[model samples]
Target: MVRISEFQIKDVVNVADGKKLGNISDIDINLQTGKIEAIIISGTGKILSLFGKEEETVIPWKNILKIGEDVILVRFNEKNEFHIQEEE
Candidate 1:
């Protein structure tokens, strides 16, 4: 079994655009069901800091295609669009 800590070190990549979405910074979990809801990626950029904007990329668990040894492959869908928004 793979531990959640293992995911923190693996790189997350998008198969649709071949974009490196960075590593897993955090995860959303459903306590009731004991299931992962999404993977959270921390944003990076100089401009983003200047604007006081810190957004995170949230990839739904359903979008994950495969979990490899070094990388996690994810598929992009309308419901899983990558975006930068203000962190709440």
Candidate 2:
């Protein structure tokens, strides 16, 4: 397993079908296991900020594509990808 320190927040995620999701807001950590549970990403669109919205979508850490020192790449399930839009 890799260390969380190797990854940074606010990194962009590229999904299939050319849908570009937003950046990482925070990370979900498992307190019991002391490991990263998932990566939280902010909702799409600029309108969210105006409405005081703070919705975040969580992608399992295992689904991550790569964890770089500067950014993180993640892949979301295609079928449930639309669920992220409603959460916003």
TM-score of 2: 0.61
lDDT of 2 by residue, 1-88 (tens): 6544444444655655335566766678899997888877766554536655455677888878876665556777756643344323
lDDT for each of the candidates?
A: 0.83, 0.63
What TM-score does each of the candidates earn?
0.80, 0.61
lDDT of 1 by residue, 1-88 (tens): 9887999999999898898888888898999999999888877743435657676788889989999999999986535377556633
| Pairs that clash in candidate 1 | none
| Residue 42 shift from truth in candidate 1, angstroms | 0.9
Best by lDDT: 1
